[model samples]
Target: MNKKLIILLSGLISVGIYMFLPADKNVLKGLAILFFIAALWITEALPITVTALLVPIVAVMTGIFDVREALSYFAHPIIFLFLGGFGLAAALHKYNLDELFAGFIMKTAGSKMIFSVIGLFIATALISMWISNTATTAIMLPVALGLISKIKERNHTTEVFILLGVAFSANIGGIGTIIGSPPNAITAANLGLSFSEWLSIGIPFMLILFPIMVIVLYVILKPKFPDMAAIYTIKTQDVFCNKKSYAVVSIFGFTIILWLLSKPISTWLGIEKGFDSIIAVFAIVLLVLFRTIKWKEIENFADWGVLLLFGGGLVLSGILSETGASVYLAKLVETHLVNYGPFLLVLGAVTLMIFLTEVASNTASAAILVPIFLVLGQEIGHFPPYELALTVGIAASCAFMLPVATPPNALVFGTERIKLKEMMKVGFVLNIICALVISVVAYLIF
Candidate 1:
C-alpha cells in the first residue's frame, strides 16, 4: 500500500482501538496520541514541526487537554533552552570560535600521536556538548579532513583511525548534559529537575566515559604513524588560521561564564520560576545586543523543526499522563519487571532509547519513553524514577551506528572515508559501554 494509506489506516485503527478498549477511555485516548506520534516519526508524512504543533492542537480538539494548557507546551522551559542554547552557539560560530579552538588544540597536541587524537576527541566532544551535533560535526569535519589529508600525503596509517575518533567523539560527548543533546534536555524537563542538577550529574559521567572511550578507540583502531617528530614540528601559524578566532574565543569564554553562573543569578533574583531558561535567553539577548551576533544570526540559530518536535512530544506525553495510559502501561511492565529492581529498569530504559534513536529521532524517543517511565517509577516506588528517565534521555543521544542515527554520524559518513560497518563496529561497542556506565552511575548517585 502507499505510505499515506498506511498512515491513514494506522490512525484509524488506533482511534478505533481507543474507542473500543475495555479499559479507561482516557487510557485509550493516550494510546492513540502516542501511536500518532510514532506513526508520524516513522512515516515522515508531515514536516516534524507541523506534526509537533498538531499534537497539542489535536489533543485539545479531542478533549485531551484544555486549549490554553496544550498551547503552553510551546513556551515550555525545555523548548526555550533549545532556542537560547542554539542562539549562543550561533553567535560563537559567527565569530568562528569553534574552529579556532579545534585548531588550537590540534596545534598544541601535534607533538604526540596519542595525545593529539585524545585532544581532538575531547575538543570535539566538548563542542558537541554545547552546540547542535550537526553544527559541531560540520565545523569539525573540515579540520578532521585537513588532518587526514596531511597524513595521507605522508602515507600514514593512523589518519583514518583519528578521523573515525573525531566523528565518534562528537556523538559520545553530547551525552554529558541536558543541553548536550535535545533528548537530554527534554528528559530533564520532564523529570522536573533543574538544568544545573542535570549538568552536575552529566559532567562526571562524561568525564568518566571520555577516557574509557579514548582507550577503546585506541585499542580497537590501533592507528600507527611514522616520524611523528616531523609532523609535530609544523608551525602553529600555518595550522591555526586566525580567521575571526579571537572574537569566537572571547564570546565563547563569556558564554561559559554566564552558563556557570546561571543558577546563582536565579537565586540572587529570588525567582523560583523558569530560571534556567531565563538565564539562557538572557545570555543570548546580551550577546546579540553586544553585536557578538546579529538578528539575522538569531533567526538562523534556532532549530524550529526540532523545537516543534519537542512540543509535539510534550503534548503527547502530557496526554498520556492526563489520560492514564502511562499508568496502565507502567503497571503492565511493573507486573513483569518490578522484581528486577532499579538496575534493570535503568538498563532496559537506556537500551530501549539507544535502539529507538537508531531508527527514530532522539527527541521523539525521549518523549515516547519519559511518561511511561514516570508512571513506572511511581508504580514500583522502590527506586527513583528520575534516574531511569534521565538514563533514557542521555542514552537517546547515543546513536552512533548509522547515518540516520545522528547528524554528526551522517556528517562524518559523508566524508566517505568511514564505512557503515566501521561506524557500527565502533558505535555498537560504545553504546553498550555508555549504557552500562550511565545505569550504574545514575543508580548510585541519584
Candidate 2:
C-alpha cells in the first residue's frame, strides 16, 4: 500500500475504534484527535505547527469544541511566553551575542580538559536556559565546530562525542526553569502556577543536575583533545573578535530581567493578572519600534515548529478536558495508584513523561499528562499538585536518546559526526539517571 493511503486507513481505523468504545462521544473524539496528532508527529508529513493547528480544527469539526474555545489556545499565555522568548532570541542572534558569549567562555577556560568540559557545560546550560534548546545548539555548534577544525586528530570519534555533548548539554541545561523548555511552560500553565514559582523549583534542580551531568559525560566519553597547552594557544581574540553589540545585549538582558521580575512588577504596579506575557509582547514591540531589532531581522528568524506543536497539543488537551476524557483517565489511575506515596507518584509521572516524550513532542506529552496528574495529585493527597506537575514539566525536557527525542538532538544529528547508536548509548543511561534524580528531588522539595 502507498504510504499516504496506509496512514489514512490507519487513522480511520483508530477513529472508528474510538467511536464504538463505551465512553463519552467527546472522549472518543478527543482520542481520535490525539491519534491524528501522533500520526503527524511520527510521519513528519506536515510541519509540526501545521499538525498542531490541525488538532483544534479537527476537534471543532468533530463537535468536540466550539471554534472560539478551540482557537483560544493560540492566545494561551504559555504560547505568548514562547513567542516573547523567541523574539528575544531573534534579537540576540541578529547581534551574534550568543556566539560572542560562547567564544568568551571557551577562551577563559584555557584548555584544561576538565575545565573545558565544565566551561562548555556552563555556557551551553546558561544559553539553553534562556533561549530554546534548538537555538542554543545552533549558536554553540559553530564554536564546537571551530574548536574541532583547529585540532586535527587521526580518529575523529572523540571530536564527534564532544560535539554531541554540546548538543545534549543544551537539552540538560534547559531543565532548569519554566522558560527553559516548552513542556515546562505547558506544565506551569496547566497547573495555574506562576512562571516565577516554577523557576524557584527549577533553578535549584538545575544546580544539582548540572554538575552530575558534567561528571557523567566526562566518565562515559573521555576527551580526545587532551593537549591543553596546544589548545590554549589558539587565540581568544580571533574567536570573539566580533565586538559585542551593546544595544542588542541591553535589550535582551532587560527582557530576561523583566520576565524574571514580572510578578513583583505586576504586584507593585497593581496590574491585573497575566501581565508576564503581556510585558514580554510589549518588550518585543518596543524593541522593534526603537529599531533595537530591525523588522527584517525579526522576519528572517527561524520558524520554530514547537509553537505550532504546542498550539495543536493545547487544542487537543482542551478537547480532552472539555470532554472530561482526562478526568476519566485520571480516575482510573487514581483508583489503582493513589495508595502509593508521593515518591511513587512522582516517579510514575516522570517515567511516563520521559517515555511518551520520546514518541511524541514534549509539549504534547505534558498536555496529555498534566490534566491527569492534576487529578491524581488531588486524589493522592500526600503532595501538592504542583509537585507532580513540575515533575512532568522537567521530564518533558529530558529527551536525550533519539534524534526525534528533542530538537537539540536533531540539530546535532545533522552534523553526521555522532551516530544514532552512540547517542542511544549515552542517552539511555542519562534518561534513567535524570528520571530518578528528578523524581527523588521533586518529592523531597515539593
Candidate 3:
C-alpha cells in the first residue's frame, strides 16, 4: 500500500470514529489524536521519529490543551540522562573501548557456534546494562558478521542466530536498571525512584528473562555446527588498552558510582530530585574536561532523533493525562475487565504493552501507556499501582518480532544477513510467549 494513502485513510478513520462516538468533545479528541499517530506509526506512513514529532502537533491543534501545557511534557530529567549515556557511548567507541570489550568476549567462545552464540549474547547483555542497547548492538555487529564469513555455513543458520542473539541480548539487558534503557528512565523519573530500588526489582526480572531468552533462541535457531572442534586464539590486551583508554575506563567507573550513589548523597545534601540529572550532566562535562572525549564527538554521538521522538511522546502522554483521556480509558478498561481479576488485568496490560511496542517506539509505548496503567491501578484499589507501572515499563521494551519492533531488531535486520520472514517466524512466537510469561511471573513476584 502507498504510505501516503495509508496515512490519509488513517486520518479519515480517526475523524469518522470521533464523530460517531457518543463521548465528550475532549475525550473523543484525544482518541482521534491517538488513533491518528498510532495508525501512521503502525503503517510506517512516515519516518517513525517524524511521526512521533507530529503527535504533539496533532494534540495541540485538536484542542486537547493549550500550547504551553502540551509543550511542557518534553522537558524532563530523563532527556539529560539519555544525552549523558549517549556521550559516554560515543566516547568509548571513539577510543575503541567498546570494540576492545566486545572483542575480548567474542574471542572466548573459540570458534564454536553454540559457545559463540552464548558469548556474543552475554557480551551484548553485559554492555547494555551500562550503556545504550542500540550502541551495543551496533558495536557487536561486525564480530557477528565476521563470524559468518569464517563459519562457512551454507544454511546460514549459525550466522543468523549469532546476529539475533546480539540484538536480543541488547534488548534484554536493558531490563536490569533504571538507566539501562529509555523506558526504564522514563519510569524512574516519573515515580521519583532511586537507582537501588529499581535494581532491587529490576535485577530479579532480568535474571529471570535472560536465560529463558538465550535457551529459547538457542533451540529455535538450532544451527548445525560442523566444526565444533575448532578453536581460535583470544587476546586480553591490545593497543586500545593503553594509558588513555584505562583513564577513560576509570572515569567511566566513577560516573557509574555517582549514578548509583547520587540519591543517597543528594539526600544528605537535602535535595529531593536527588541529583540524577545533575550527576549525568556532570559526568558528560568531566569526560570532556579531562580530554577523554571531544566537543565535536558529543554532537556526533548524541541520538538527536531518538531524543526528539521521546520528547514528542512525552508531550502526548501529558495530553492524555491532563485532558483526562487516561482516566477515561481506565474507566473503560474497568468496565470491561472488572470481573477478570487482578491476574487478567495485569496480564492484559502487559500484553497490550508488548504488542504496542512492536508497532511504535518502545519508549513512546511506555510513555503513552504507563500513565494509563497508573490510573487503572488507582481505580481498582486492589491492584498494586507501583507494580503495574513497572510491569508496563519493563514489558514495553520486550519487543522481538518485527524489525520495526525496536531499534536493535532493526539494526540487526539492516545487515541483510537475516530475513524479514525469518525474524517474524521466530519473533512472533517469542513475542507472544514472553509477554505472557513476563506478565504471569511478574504477577507472582510483585
Name the candidate that leads on TM-score: 1
Clash counts for the predictions, in order: 0, 1, 0
Q: List residue ranges in candidate 1 displaced over 4 A.
A: 152-160, 229-255
Show pairs that collide, candidate 3: none
lDDT of 2 by residue, 8-39 (tens): 87588767858787887767766666666667
Native-referenced Cα lDDT, model 2: 0.74
Tell me how far the alpha carbon of residue 400 in candidate 1 is from the true structure, in angstroms, after superposition: 1.8
Which portions of model 3 show Cα errors greater than 4 Å? 1-20, 58-68, 107-113, 152-155, 226-242
Give the C-alpha lDDT of model 3: 0.78
Q: What is the number of residue pairs that collide in model 1?
A: 0
Each prediction's TM-score against the native? 0.91, 0.90, 0.90
Error of 1 at 321 (Å): 1.5
- CA lDDT of each prediction against the hidden true structure: 0.75, 0.74, 0.78
Poorly placed runs, candidate 2 (over 4 Å): 1-3, 42-46, 111-113, 152-157, 230-244, 302-304
Looking at candidate 3, the ten consecutive residues that score lowest on lDDT are 228-237
- Please tell me which model should have the higher lDDT, number 1 or number 3: 3
